[model samples]
Target: MRSQENGPIKIDGIDKMILNAFMENANIPVSQLAKDLGISNTAVHQRIKKLETSGVIDSTKVIVNPTVLGYSTMSFVGVFMNKPSSYKLVLNSLEEIPEVIEAHFTTGNYGIFLKILCRDNLHLMNVLNQKIQQIEGVTRTETIISLEQPIVRQIKL
Candidate 1:
């Protein structure tokens, strides 16, 4: 079926429950999910397949601990760009960098803001000087280095 332009996909109660279960653990097996939801494994598998085909469920991935990898410095940089009009063109450009974790457009003095994860001062400096500043319209930036983050998990259904 053809989907409408710019509207959220309608999710029924059953689908919502299935999605919530999967969100908690993307690598969950169909049998376990079926057992937990009190449904047949076949039903769970079909629903997951449907969601994937419809573009609602993207690829599953493993979430890793950055601290365990010895990447301790976490910084949020709010960059003010001179060229404020090119958001879409610039957003993709920012995502190309490996260090940039999140880039958001907000209503503030800054045109673009990014959350960057770096190994140390040298890494962070390289990201700023070579990577970020190279982007057009990035006039000024204010970086807030996080000493410690209380939480960094997504809150879902």
Candidate 2:
């Protein structure tokens, strides 16, 4: 429960234990979790349901390995637009491109930032020159290819 209006929700030690366990393995069985936590299966289920209702748990997802599908190159792109009003249209256009895995309306030199995946440098160039640059409002783009990603994890509970 939240202590104040629109404030962060308050959770106990047991709640933290449950969240940490689930964070390690979302597919962990409820029975196993209950046994590890020394609580009943019903208790674990109730806590998870409560966490979901309180908006702490958004949704479970299957993380995919892009390399297995031949998407080896990962690049971050900073996109500049002709005008701020073109944001919505540009966003809608970006949504249609499957290579654009993530997009952000950020506070910096670029009006928008994108994380894209492709097979190689050539594929990245084609995506940038042919698709992204062709957007009506897109004026320019700056791209940086990732050589290695050492850290990728959620926030500490």
TM of each candidate vs. truth: 0.82, 0.95
Each candidate: what lDDT?
Answer: 0.82, 0.93
Cα RMSD, model 2: 1.6
Candidate whose lDDT is highest: 2
Put down candidate 2 lDDT per residue, 1-157, tens digits, no spaces: 6634679989888889888888888999999999999999999999999888888888888989999989999999999999999999999999999999999999989999999999999999999999999999999999999998999887767
What are the clash counts of all predictions, listed in order?
0, 0
lDDT of 1 at 103: 89
Tens digit of per-residue lDDT, candidate 1, span 66-130: 97998889999998877768677677779899999998898878888899999997899999999
Query: How much is 156 displaced in model 1, in angstroms?
Result: 2.6
